[model samples]
Target: MSLARIYRGGLPSSKFIDVALGQGARLLIRRSSDRGIRGLMGRQSERRWIRMGHNLIQAGKAKRGRGMHTSGETDMQGKAKRGRGWAIALSVLAAAAVLGFGGYHLWLHRDVRVYVNGVPVDIRYRSSFGEICDEAGVVPEAGDLYSIAGNLIATGGGGPFTVSLDGVELSEAQLDAVEVEGGESFTVRDGDDAVEDSEVVERITAPRLVPAERLAAVTYVSQWGANGIDRVRVGAVSGEEILEEVVQEPRDCVLASVNPVPSDGRRLVCLTFDDGPSPYTAQVLQILEEKGACATFFVLGSNVGPWSDAIQGLEAAGCEVMSHTMNHRNHYATTSDETYRETADAFAALRDCAGVYTSVIRPPYGNWNEHCWISSRGTMSASVIWNVDSRDWELPGADAIVENCTSGIENGDIILLHDGGGDRSQDIEALPRIIDILREQGFELVTLSELMDADDRIPDEAARQYAPMPEDCAWPAQIAE
Candidate 1:
C-alpha cells in the first residue's frame, strides 16, 4: 500500500511503535529515506537504525550469489544489485512494522480522550463508547447521542435524524459493530434539515366568538373566546419557524361567560331619546353614526318642522322616530285635552315628515296616568318607559350620566336619554360612552320596537305598556302627573 494510505489511518508508524510495538519496531521507520520519518526519530533511534541497516546489507550479500556469477555480465549485475538489494530489505521491514503494530496494546496508562459537541473528556481507555460512557457515568436515553469509534448509535425523533460514522449512517445493529477501544470522537445533534429548508412558520391564531345569527333578535354573549398560540397548534418546536402555521391540531376550547342563547340570537338594548330632533339631535346622531349604534328618537310635535332635517336623518339612518308629547305637557287630568293634542300631533308630525309610523310613545315625565293612558290608549300602541336612566335632564356631569346609564344594565334594557329638553351637551357627551360601555358589556343597542319585540316577547309584556287608572282612580294619577 502507498505511504499516503498508511498516513490516512491517522496512527503514525513511529508513534504506534512507541505506544504498542516498543523500541524494537521504531528502527524500521528511522531507516526510511523520507525526510519526515527521519526527522521524527531521536538520536538513539537513528543509531539503532544504522545497526539494522548493516545487518540487512550482510543478509542481502549472502543471497546475491546463490547461483554462479559470470565474469562477462559481472559489472551490469553489480549495478543492478547495488540499487535493488537495500530497497527489497527496507520494503519488507516497513510492511512488517505496519501489520505488527496495527493491533498493538497501549499499556502506558494515560488519559484517553472522548469528545462531545467539541468539548474534550479525559478518561481511561474503555472497550466501547457505551463502556466509556458507563465508566464516565454517561448513559444515553432515547434522544441522547452515542458513538462507538466513529459510528453513531441509532437515535431519531421519529423522523429523519441521521447519525453517521465517517459519513455512513448506521442503524443500532451497525452501531454495535463499532468499538470505542481508545480515543475516538462522536457527535450528538438534533437534525432538522427538512424543517429548516422550508420557510413555513407555525403559529396559533386567537380564539374569537363567532356569534351566529338568530331569529329571536335577543341573546347575550355566552362565550368570550380567548387568543391561542398558533393556527393549528400552540407552542413551536425546535427547527420550526413558527411564522404562520403548524401541522398538529390544537384542542378547541369552549369558554362561556354569559347565559346561553340561540346560536344566531342578538341581544336588544334601546337607546331612547325622550324629547329630541333638536339642534343637539345632530350631535347625537353623529355620535350614533361614529359608534354604529341605532336609537329611538321620541320626536315632539313642537320641534318637528324646525328640526325636520335632523329628525328625518335619524329615521333614514335606521332609528325609531316616535312621539313625545307636543309642547311638553304633563300627563294630568287638567291638561288631558292639551296632552292628547300634543301626543297626537307629535305622532302625526313624525309620520308626515319621515314617512314612518311608530306604535310607541314616551309620555312626558315617563308618566302613564289615568289622563294620559286614557287619552293615548287606542292611538298609542305602547308607552315606552326606561330601565336605564342617564338622568342627563338633571344636568348631572357627563360622567355621572354615563355611570347611571351603564350601571345595572340588562338584556332588553331601555336606556333613556334626551337630544332635546334643555342644554343637551351632557347628553351628547354621555351618549357615545353609554353605547361603548353597553357594547363592551356585550349589550346590542337597538330601537325601542326592536327591544320590545326581542326574544319573541309580546310588545305589551316587553314594554312599559299603557297605564290603567290608579287604584283610587285619581290619587296615583295626581302624584304621577
Candidate 2:
C-alpha cells in the first residue's frame, strides 16, 4: 500500500507504525495478500485507477520498496508500529494521572484553618490551639473551647480560660474585658468647666478569675476585746481550703498587705539589668560592687556561655544572676508552651553555667501577659517587673540617665536598666554617679530578690500583680536607682 493509502485504524491494536516519505516521482504499495490490490482499489476505486496509470515505471514488490510496487509485510509492520504509539501515549497519560492525584491529596490535607471568635484564621500549618490564638490575637479564656469543624482541638482551663481542642485541654488567662456599668451621672470637666451635662462612665476589669485559684486570699475578722480593733488576716489558700496563713497581724489599712504595697521607710531600690554580659556590664558591676550594692542581672542564656568569666565575676560580686530567657523574644506574642520552654531553657542554662537556681525572670522587651504566667506556672520562678525604668536603651547621655533614674527613686522601687543589648556605654558611664546620687537621696541599691524579701515574693501573688498592661505603660518611665 502507498503511504497515503495507509489507514491507522484498521491495524491490529498491538502494532505501531513508523512512516518516512521522500520528495520523488515514485510510489510503493504494500499489502498482506495477492488480493491486496483489489482490496485497496475497492476502498478508493476512483483514486486507485488514476494512481496505477500515473505510476507504471516501477511495479514490483520488494523488502525495501522504493518505486511503484506492492508489499504485504511492510504494510503489516506500519500498522503494528501505529498501534505501539497509541499504547505508549496511554502509558504516559496513566503515569501523569497518578502524580496529579498524589499532589492534589497532599495539597488538600497539608494545612488546617483556625478560627477565633467565629472568625476564620489563616494558620496554614498544624500547630497547637494556643499558637493559633496568639496569631489571631485572641487571648485564650479559661474554660474556652477551641474547635475545628465541630471537632474539639484544644481545651483551656487555667490562666483565664480553659480551651478544648482535639481532645486536649489547655488553660490560659483571658484578656481584660471592658464592662459598662450604670453609675451616678457625671459631668465632663474640661479646664474646670463641665463641657457635657452628662457623661457615661466606663470601667474595664480583668477577665473573670482564671480557673486557677488566687495566689493569695484575704479575710477580715473583728476583735471584740480591749482595743476594739478589727484584724485583717491575709492567707495563701488553695481552692479547697487555706494552705497557709500569710499575715495575721493587725493593720490600720485594710488594703495595706492585700497587695504588694511598698513601704514608705528609707528608699529601698532594686536594680535590674537585662541582656547582660557585655563589656559595659563589667563596668556597671564594678560600680555596683564599689558601692556595696547588689542588683539583679537577667542575663540571656546565649550570652552566658561566651561570657562565663564575666558572669562568674558578677555573681562573685554579689549580683543575682537570673533568667532573661534563651532568646529575648516577646513572650506575649509567642505560644504558651514555647514561652515556657524558653524560660525553662534559660533557667537550665543559668543553673548549668552559673551554678545558681534563680526564681526571678524579666521577660524580653518586658512583654508579659496572662500567657506568661501560665507558661511559668510551676516553674519555680516569680516574674520580676520594674517600677522604675531609666530607658538607658535609648542611648541617652550619662547625665540624662542619672536624672531619669534618680527622678523616680522611692521606697521599695524596682529600677530597670540594661547592661546587654547594644551600646550600654551610657549605662556604664552613668552607674557611679547614679549610685552616688541615689545614696545621697537616701536610696539603697539592692537585688530584686532582696527587695522582694522586704515583703515575701510569693509566686501567685507576684503573678497576679505582674499581669500584662498596655504597651504604652509596659515599662516604667523613670528609675529609682
Candidate 3:
C-alpha cells in the first residue's frame, strides 16, 4: 500500500501496514495462549490468517484510480453515505412499529366498571359474569339466589328456590353461563326463608269390586262403591309428600255373581203384579184360576191387614206372594234406613198374613237403585224387575195393555201389571189374553221362584240364600245382618 493514499485518509501507509502486521502477530499469539482459540483454530493455517491480515491492509488503502478528486471515488463515498442513511431510517421505522403495536394493544383492552354483588368492580370490557364474580371475590354456592343486572340466576341445591328476574320467574335452563356488560347490579338471598309449603286435595283411592262366587244366577250388589279423599302436603322443594289422614274411607262394592243361568230350554215366564192386595186382587186371582195359570202377587205390607182374605186366596190358589214394601215409596230416592224398615215390615206382613216365606220384592214404580239393592239384601234374595210392561196403570185400554205384554215376550221374562195403585180393570182384562198369547208363543207362565227353580244347576240352598250379602260388606250393620 502507498503512503499517498493512506495520507489522503489521514493515516501513513507504512504505519497502517505496520499496525495490520502487529494486529496479526498479536492475534496469533493470543490464539496460542487462549485455550478456546487454540481449540477453534487447531486446524487453521498461519498463512491463511496472514492472507486475511493482508486483505485488511488493502481495505484500509483508498482506491483512487485516476485522481484524488475523481468522480468514481466521490460516487462510492456518496453511495456509502446513502446506505448508512437507509439503515438508520429502517431502524427508526422498526422501533416506531413496535411502539405503535404496544399502544394499540393497550387501547383495545380497555377497563370497564361493573357492580357484582353490589360491589363496584373494574375489569376488561366484555368480561363474563363468572370472570366479574371472580374479580370481585364473590363465590356463589348452591341454592344461592343471585341476580345480575336485575336478572335472577338460581343455583340448584337441596331446596327449591323461587327466583325471579325483573318480576318474571326464570326457567331451569337460564340459570347457567351468564354473561354481562358493565354497570350491572347483583343481589342474593336465601330461598328457605322466603318459600312456604302448600297443601292440595288428592284422591286417596278408587272403589274396588268384591266378588261372591256362590249365589243364584243373578248379580247382587251388597255394598255400594264410594271413592275416598285425602289432603296432600306439597313442598316447594320436595314436591308432593306427607299425605294427611284420609278424609273419607273408600267403600268397595260387594258384587256377588251367581252361577250363569242354565239354558234348560224351559220356556218359563213369570207374571208378577205390583201394588196389589186391593179389590183387584180377587179379580186377578179369578183370572189366573180361570186360565189355569199360577201368578205372583207383590202385595203391600200396609194393605196386607185390610186385604188378608185376598192375600190368603192368592196363597191358597198356588200363587206365590212377594212384598212390595209397606208404603209404595220410590225406593231409589228413599234412604237405606227407611227402605230397611219398610222391607222388614213387608216381609213380616207377608209371613203373618198368608204364611208366605218369600225372599223377593218388586220395587214400587220399578225405580230401584244401588241404595235400595244394598239395603234390601238382608230381607230379599232378589228384587224382581219386570221386562214386559202391561201399561195398565196408564189405562191405555185393555187391547193396548195386551199388545205391550205380548209384543216382545221372551222366555225367562217377567211381565209387569198393576192391580192396586189405581183402577186395574184394564190389567184384569189383559191378564187372560196375555196368558193365552204367552202360552201360544210356547212360554209357560210361572212365578219368579218357579222360573229360578227350573235351572237345576243352582243349588237349592244357594237359591234359598238371600242375595249373597257378605258380613263384611260396607253397609249399615242391620242391613248387612
Best by lDDT: 3
Instruction: Estimate the overall C-alpha local distance difference test score of candidate 3.
Output: 0.64
In order of TM-score, best first, we have: 3, 2, 1
The digit string of per-residue lDDT tens for model 3 on 266-360 reads 78887888887888888888889998999888889998888888888887898888888889888777887898888889888877876767666
Model 3: CA > 4 A from native: 1-262, 456-459, 462-481
lDDT of 1 by residue, 9-116 (tens): 322333332233234445545555544444444455456555666555565455456524656476456546654654455566567555533323233234577764
Model 3 TM-score is 0.46
Candidate 1 C-alpha error for residue 17, in Å: 99
What lDDT score goes with residue 37 in model 2? 34
**Alpha-carbon error at 211 in model 1, in Å?**
39
What's the residue-level lDDT of 161 in candidate 3?
Answer: 48
- Candidate 1 Cα misplacement greater than 4 A, ranges: 1-266, 333-335, 459-481
lDDT of each: 0.56, 0.53, 0.64
Candidate number with the higher TM-score (1 or 2): 2
Q: List clashing residue pairs in candidate 3.
A: none
